[model samples]
Target: MATIDLTGTDFEQTVNDNEIVLVDFWAEWCGPCKQFAPTYSAVSEKHEDIVFAKVDTEDQQQLAAAASIRSIPTIMAFKDGHLVFNEAGALPPQALESLIEQLKELDVEKALRESGQSE
Candidate 1:
């Protein structure tokens, strides 16, 4: 499964309503994004449990701005309508895979509650 093209209109519905969503924010002119595309696609194919989406920064400026994406190849993972991970950089296949595996083990709601308590 390659990355799904997400636009401003469908972004909320796709990410919020979905169980787990991994969004890759990128642009055609970005070299690192181009370099990371293949790895992203490969991982998407392997991770059947997650919904992989891509937003073209050039095309979806509104969505990019709303997400506060200042850099290309920003990857974000969302679960249960909450952001679990937000990182800017092009990751190698192995690192991306490892990160996703770690995310799978995390209980986001519990973590959020604990953090809120600490705050």
Candidate 2:
């Protein structure tokens, strides 16, 4: 699972179409983003079940605004077409692995019900 580039046009489809998606919001000029890219890519390679994607904030300003992303290298996880995790800062490889494990444990159906997205 390589990291896919997400643009304004394909943003919704990319997230909604996948059962579990992890998006990294980053910009080319950010040092932290540059440092985090390799870790993100490595994580993607390790996890085949999760769809990993990245959005270039400079090019996708509208998408970034819609996502309420104010910082560089924000990571968001979506499950069942709903946002499950949104956080800023760079995560170590081990931390990212732990996050994936946590996401796997999440009952998305139950979460959707609790969030009033389902009956």
- Model 1 segments beyond 4 Å from truth? 117-119
Query: Which 10 successive residues of model 1 have the least lDDT summed?
Result: 110-119
Query: lDDT by residue for model 2 over 1-119, one digit each (tens)?
Result: 79999999998998899889999999999999999999999889988999999999999999999999989899999987888899999999999999999998999889788888775
- Residue 111: error of model 2 in Å? 2.3
Score candidate 2 by TM-score against the native: 0.93
- lDDT tens digits by residue: candidate 1, 2-59: 6799999999999888778999999999999999999999999999988999999999
RMSD, model 2, all Cα superposed? 1.3
TM per candidate: 0.94, 0.93
**Residue 34, candidate 2: alpha-carbon lDDT:** 99
Give the residue spans of candidate 2 off by over 4 A: 115-119
